[model samples]
Target: MEIATYILVPFILFALTGLKVMNEYERGVRFRLGNYSGVVNPGLRYIIPVIDTMQKVDLRVKAVDVPSQDAMTKDNVSVNVNAVLYYKISDAKNAIIEVEDFKFAVSQLAQTTMRDIVGETTLDRLLSERESVSLRIKELVDKASDPWGIKVNSVELKDILLPSDMKRVIAKEAEAEREKRAVIIKAEGETIASVNLSKAAKTLAGNKGALHLRTLQTLNDIASDQNNTIVLALPLEILESFRGKNK
Candidate 1:
């Protein structure tokens, strides 16, 4: 009885060691005698003890944050840029076979591709056309990583850091542009006001009594403020009219 108990214990241990349970998101790449075998789907899987090995890979979308890279723009501007990369493993077999480390490979590929795309783009376009540039980087990286079984979902430019001096220069240029527009608008307003004043003057001159009526209206406006005193100067036309009335 003691000998049978010892033997069964060893057999139970070996059987437990061969049993593997994979989650829903996991796939097991099985190798038999160091040769490519088949992929084990999510469930209880059995492997021969000391003969077959399995590597579990999670088939899930992953986000990798690329560190900031110092890049020079096409317009000769220096900037620091960072981005995020979204990717997934399309073919798990190729991912494990074609690359030593698929995640690291994709990350490095994204970094270099970002720098290359940034170098090709001017500073103005890089600042303005972020979506287009990100799509371009995604396409290039996706195409390059196809053999490695990585599908690049999307790429996003997160932040762009410019030099302090460049920021100040941009601020000053914007201020100057705003001032220029203000001056132009003020000049246009003045030109319109001058044209209107000239028309008013011509109308007042052609119509008799218009000037006197305007002067009376000004005096009435000034008199509306009870705290103010006004001096009225009668024009020569008023005196001539009075003289004609006396005659």
Candidate 2:
């Protein structure tokens, strides 16, 4: 019984040592004798004890937040900006082997690219054409990360920190622009109203009775206001004075 017990103990230890379970989203890279061995699929996988090792790599999307970095604009304005990067490990093998740390390297690349892009664009362009900036950043980041088998899905500007003075200046400029637009709009409205009034005058002049009706309408409007005193100059009153003077 002792001999059978000893034999079963070694067998059980070996069985447990060789067992490895991989999840659905994980791929196991096996190394046999410190040499490359094919990847093992999900579910139960066996490896020789003390002779083989497994490294599990996750094949999932990852979000990397780039810390705020100071950059100078083309106009020589200094600003701090931060961004977020969405990426995925497309080729687990290259991701694990090509770069020492893919995430770190990509982050550093992103930081550099951000500075480079900022240096090439003016502050106004950066604020107004943010989509173009984002595209440029994504392109540069993706190009740099492609070798590591990482796909940068997108790059978004999280925040842009401008100087207080610059902010105040921009605000004032915006206010002035708004005031200018308001004045232009008001002038346009007045011009349109004047044109409409001229058209109505021409129409009323074509029919003298319409002009009298319009004058009566104005009198009615004033009367409806419930005023104490009212003054009106009717065409007949002027015509009667002219007739009396001619006689």
Candidate 3:
């Protein structure tokens, strides 16, 4: 009985000390005697007191804020840009074995990729096509970090700060563009109006009585105004007939 007591007590102590609890969002990368072993799932797990080891890796997605980086656009404009990135570890084993620090590695890769993309794109496209630029950054970063077991979900450009002079210049350019369009539209309307007026004049000239009736209509319109007094003009033939009758 004494022999069994000694053996059982030591076994119970070792077992209790080796107990490891992992949460639902955690995965364990087990290593035995410095050799890579298979991953352990969530819940109570066991490891030998001095022979086995485990590193916990969170499976949840992480949000990383990339700092503003100074970059020159293809059009030679200087700007500062920052972004937010979403990533998660796809393979816990590769993430541990392949990279020294997976989080730092991924972040550095994102920064460089963003700068490179910004350098390649012009200021106009960078501002107008922000979604496309972000998608491009996501793709390049995701591809580069695939070997490190990282999965880049999305990238968002939070802000792009331009130079003060550049802002004023863009504003002026936009204003000029609007003014140009307005001038063109007004000129087109005037041209159409002139063409219609010319056609109406030609039609009226073809009929002799049309001019007389149009003159009467103009006089009638003027007479509608209380402030204006219209005068009548008698034709020379009508005046001669009146003089003859009086004689």
Candidate 4:
């Protein structure tokens, strides 16, 4: 009984070692006798304990945050930029066979590509045209990593840091632009007011009593504020009217 018990325990342990269970999101890359066998899908799988080995790979979309990298823009502005990358493993076999470490390789490639793209772009465009730059980065990265079975879905520019001097310069430039626009608007308003004033003068001269009526309205407006005193030098028209009224 003792001899039979020892034999059964060893057999049971060996059988248990051959069984492997994979989840739905995982695929096993199998190798038999050190030669590539193929992929084993999720389910109950068996491999010879000493002759076969398997590596499990998760087939799911992943988000990778790229660290900030310093780069000089085409206009010679130095800036720090970081981004996020979304990718998935399209082909598990090539991912393992072609790249030593797929995730690290993709990250390094993304960093270099970002710096390259930033170097060719102006600071203004990089700040304003962020979406286009991100799309371009995604395209370049996807193309470069395609061989390693990485499918880059999208890339987003996370943050852009500018120097303090650059920020101050930009603020000053914006302030100057606002002041320029205000001056133009004020000048336009003055031009319109002058044009209306010219028309008003012409209308008053064409009509007999319009100027006197306007003068009376102005006096009325000044008199509405009782706390103020107004001095007026009566015009010759007003004097003539007063003389005619007396006659």
Instruction: Pick the lDDT winner.
Output: 4
* Residue lDDT tens for model 2, 1-247: 9999999999889879989998889888788898878787889889888889887888888898988999999999999999999898887777877898888998999999998999999999999999899899999999988989899999999899999999999999999999999999999999999999999999997887888899899888888896798685768658869999999
Cα lDDT tens digits, model 3, 207-228, are 7588668878887888888875
In model 4, the worst 10-residue window by lDDT is 227-236
lDDT of 1 by residue, 1-247 (tens): 9999999999999979999999999888889999979888999989998899988888899999988999999999999999999998888788888899999999999999999999999998998899999999999999999998889999999999999999999899889999999999999999999999999999998886987789789888887887757576788578889999999
What local lDDT score does residue 216 receive in model 4, on the 0 to 100 scale? 86
Candidate 4 C-alpha lDDT tens digits along 1-247: 9999999999899978999999999888889998989998999989889899998888899999999999999999999999999999989898988899999999999999999999999999999999999999999999999999899999999999999999999999999999999999999999999999999999998876887788789888888887758567589577889999999
Give the clashing pairs for model 2.
Answer: none
lDDT of each: 0.92, 0.90, 0.93, 0.94
Candidate 1 stretches with Cα past 4 Å from truth are 184-220, 226-247
Q: What lDDT is obtained when candidate 3 is compared to the true structure?
A: 0.93
The candidates, ranked best first by TM-score, are 2, 4, 1, 3
Local lDDT at 119 for model 3: 99
Model 2 CA deviation exceeding 4 Å by range: 226-229, 236-247
Q: What is residue 162's positional error in candidate 1, in angstroms?
A: 2.5
**Candidate 1: clashing residue pairs, number:** 0
Worst-scoring 10-residue span by lDDT in model 2: 229-238
